[model samples]
Target: MTTSTAAPPPPPAARAATPPEPPSAGRRRQRKGSMRRREAITGLLFVSPWILGFLVFTLGAMVYSLVISFSRYQLATDTARPAGLANYEALITDPKIAIALGNTLYYAVLAVPLEIALALGLALLLNSVRRGAGFFRTVFYLPKMTPTVATASVFLLLLNGSTGAINRGLAAIGIDGPDWLLDPAWVKPSIVLMTVWGVAGTMVIFLAALQNVPKELHEAASIDGAGAWRRFWHVTLPLISPAVLFNVLVLTIAAFQIFDQAFLLFHRTTGTGSSDASLFYAIYLFEQAFRQFNFGFAAAMAWLLFVIILVISIIQMRVGNRFVYYEGGDR
Candidate 1:
């Protein structure tokens, strides 16, 4: 009784509690691999439409054109016959090809610079606006919304050598405006005017680039006794050089393929000597393909244009990369 019941037998020898087992490495690796595969499948699904369209429409057409370039399509038989390099040979021997190429080159040189300058100037003005900026931007962009055919029609009336408003204004100033559409000397310039009218797209791109520039940099530039011109030239220009490069490359390619304005202005009058001034490469290619039914020659011309554009684009990108300044010092 004094001993009380036997003290409970000493607890079983203490055993350390074991930690829960972690997931096996193999299982972990399998889960991560599955997740990545799911993500990749999702990404591919998102881009599938674009991939399909490019394959069917763009790549397919390019391949077909390449094939047809080496063959003559006989209208009577409605078939293509292999002609080897004859079509390509015609490109070099044809005088009209040189003329068309010269005209296209001239237009590209003239239009690219004008478009860049005008677009940049417009962007600068827009960037300075604090009030009614949206309204002004809309007004400026309206021309781009206009259809090419409608714009061409309006230009015809404006470019009429005799009764045009431009000529009347020149008359008021006691200066004689040249026959814009008819005169060989002024025809290209007239087309350039039309091209510049639709430069709002480029201006908008510049505006977006300008807005992205750090305001602190500009403030610092101003504090350094840099005037507006100096700030723009030294600070703003370098900051926005990448955008300039983009616009330049785009405008150059577009200028090379210019067709609508030239065709609208000169197609009807092509037999007339004055229309010769507007005989661009694109228009000539159209003539060969549709009017003359020389599909093989036209295909060759298309390939030649493609080559020219490819070469020029490569050259521009390389040169532009050297000059373009990005925020991180990488182009």
Candidate 2:
């Protein structure tokens, strides 16, 4: 009684359950490999400029400096002659080298810690801001934007012993301020103050690090009866200690190479300012290279500084690794 058409001949065997035979394994791999090669070529092209610049400028200059450090450069003939170990020996025998190194060391010791603390404090305050944070950050960062020459000119006036704003302020507060620029004891401190004035860069770095910290850690600590101080000490400080280490290492290196502010503040064109107190290693190196035309000695000094910085950086990384907490494990 069924007038069926036999179900339309069973739908033609359902098309054999095979997916168009996927191009073969070798062909697929070849296509993928071609794509990767193209990607790699594009990446190399994008980064080629930086690589070229590093090779030509930084590495080339370093190599040139290292070569000249062993020879006496004749400015008249624009040539260099072998000088044996005279330049390296002078590094040890020169009295000015010691004085310059001592001054630089003192500045580093004073500036690095102060800058870290102040930068961290500013970062904390900025991070806590719920309103107009951008404006506050911009205002705080203005000092870092300021040109070194202009900053020096302004501080030269502000630090004047007789009628400077700083002394005036001190006097108003019933305190006597020292001769900031003139006195040997205060000269380094004055430079440190100028160095601190441009600490907004470091503060911004700290602010970035602080913002990345997990808020849940603070909340958990708080729930566990941790006061603000305790929470900050136990929860916040450890999380932020990597940033602290970074800032410390960078500031220390920069402190060693301090030149612009010291030169502008102390070694002006008029030949005024305290050369003795502000005679940093860089300043001395500059004088040797350009002023006295002792290029070999200056080059030697540069190499010595490079070695010193390298050693210190190694020591810092080793020591810092122990204290710096890595949320994802040790880097």
Candidate 3:
């Protein structure tokens, strides 16, 4: 009875009362929050330059151009006056635009497949070589590193109709070489040849893709009595389809934007060639923007080209997804 009476139970409120958090614990939490804020500020500071550059140079310019496309822009006066869709109307009415677009399409059709084929062939050859492989690879890739102007100059000499090495070689073989640069039929082919010379880059891509193909698949195909042709057609081609599609898409885009080679070859301080065969879309856009000072028209042309590229890219990607094989599975 004395022990029971020694202490009464504390009140429920007192029993439930909890001790306050330590002052050090509160300070530590505040320090953690401050450290997080500092880290966020540091990250923003580090990326600020890139953000500013992109906004000013890329996005700002794009927005300005878009606005100019809907106006009559005079570069001489640096003025842009609203003109509605008049600039875009020219795209439909101008025959030169059609001709330029047709030429670009033709070049893309010819160059893309040829580049892919040649690149694949070279990649296959390089992949098969065991000795002097690195040397051969370097030798083949050197053309891609050559300056475009220098390459165009050398090709200008090599493609001379009357006395160039190419025609001379053709004569030696008892065949006549076409006037590559002068002839309308051959101008694009000449460009294609020049483009193929730089196929070393695409070839390297294909070579990497080919090398990445699991050797075990090939060995298994061989064990299954698959012939060389069968193994290549079934096993090798599927594995490399993604690379093939990628190269084709890239080459197609480059082909559409062909300006330098055509300009250097067919256009000069004098004038464009007799035929309009070499007047690519990019060349037309340049002429509109710089030569004619029709910035509005040039902007329209740029937007049109952008739309075409975007649509074509979308189509290619959609089509490619069906055929391209990912290791894990299609995404």
Worst 10 residues of 3 by lDDT: 266-275
- RMSD list, candidates in order: 9.5, 9.3, 6.5
User: How much is the lDDT of residue 302 in candidate 1?
Assistant: 97
TM-score for each predicted model, relative to the true structure: 0.90, 0.91, 0.86
Error of 1 at 200 (Å): 0.3
lDDT of the candidates, in the order given: 0.92, 0.92, 0.91
Candidate 3 lDDT over residue span 1-331, tens digit each: 3555557777676466688999999999999999999999999999999999999999998898899999999899988899999999989999999999999999999999889999999999999999999999999999999988898889988999998899999999999998887788888899888888898999999999999999999999999999999998999999999898898789888988998888887776555453488889999999999999999999999999989988998999898889888778864
1 or 2: which has the higher TM-score?
Answer: 2
Q: Which model scores highest in TM-score?
A: 2
Residue 258, candidate 2: alpha-carbon lDDT: 98
Candidate 2, residue 39: the lDDT equals: 100
User: Each candidate: how many clashes?
Assistant: 0, 0, 0
* lDDT of residue 206 for candidate 3: 98
